[model samples]
Target: MVDFIVGKYNYWIYIVLMMIGFYAMIGKKNLIKKIIGMNIFQTAIILFYVSIGCKKGATLPILGHAHGHAGQAIQTSAYINPLPHVLMLTAIVVMVATLGVALAIGIMIYLKYNTLEEDEILKAVK
Candidate 1:
């Protein structure tokens, strides 16, 4: 049990963070708070995905010099997979864009209603 917990502690941490973000998004009343929660959740997911791509005792994917000898083979296990890193980069860009758009909308709503609270905004709208 100790070995399992120790080996996978990062996963547990990510899960806890994800839960907090999820709760904030669902349980919070204020629009800004919900946006913050969504950002937290996105960060947790990005971290989780990046962590998954990491390998023990692995080097970067950059190729070393080609050996003159024919028997020398590049070991796949020596290099870490780069796909997850690239995907996470794309995800981060998307997340930032989305957050910017959402915040802009929030600001517009606030300007019109003068309240960031969802309930209050609804009341104002009605």
Candidate 2:
């Protein structure tokens, strides 16, 4: 149990970060705070994916001279699996675009309502 927990500390840390972000998104009344929380949540997920994609002895999946041997059989296991990293890169781009759009909308809301709080906006709306 101890070994398992100790070995997977990165997962535990990210989980805590994810939960904190989740709470901030759900519990905060300010639109800016919620946006920040969402960004944090997305960042945590990206970090988690990146962390899991790494291997201790793995090199990049480049096509040249793996393991100091040119013109030799390339071992697949020697290279890192880059799918998760690639997917996370795309996710990061999407996350940034989403954040920009969300913030723009939030700014529009504040402009119209003169406030950024969810409760205040709702009260103003109705």
Candidate 3:
């Protein structure tokens, strides 16, 4: 039972992290906390993607044919899928950009209201 659980545990961890991030975002009253939650949420997603991309005994997909002349050789074996890694890289960039924007907006809000509390900002806006 332990082995079985261990074999397929990444999904469970991903779900738990996702839920924690969601709860933090919803339950926190501070802008910084919400941002942290967002970061956690993004990290959880990245983790899920990376976990899914992993192959049990595959090597990085680096084509040796690029540097030398090789007759077309058909080889069928395990090779790491580069798509997920590329997608994750793009996702990381987008997440960082999003976080930067969120932080900038939060800073603007703080400057306007002199507080980082969501409730206080809402009250002040009213």
Assess every candidate by TM-score: 0.88, 0.90, 0.86
**Sort order, lDDT high to low:** 2, 1, 3
Residues 1-126, model 1: lDDT tens digits: 999999998899999899999999999999989999999999999989988988999988676654553478778788888889999999999999999999999999999999999999999999
Query: Candidate 1 — which residues are off by over 4 angstroms?
Result: 64-72
Predicted candidate 2 versus true structure: per-residue lDDT over 27-68, tens digit per residue = 999999999999999989998998888887988867664457
Cand. 2 TM to true fold: 0.90
Q: How far out, in Å, is residue 53 in model 1?
A: 0.5
Worst 10 residues of 3 by lDDT: 69-78
Expressed as tens digits, the lDDT of each residue in 5-79 for candidate 3 is 898799889989998988889999999999999889888999899888888787776766655636666343556
Consecutive 10-residue window with the lowest summed lDDT within model 2: 62-71
Candidate 3: deviation at residue 60, Å? 2.0
For each candidate, how many residue pairs have backbone atoms clashing (under 3 Å)?
A: 0, 0, 0
- lDDT, candidate 1, equals 0.90
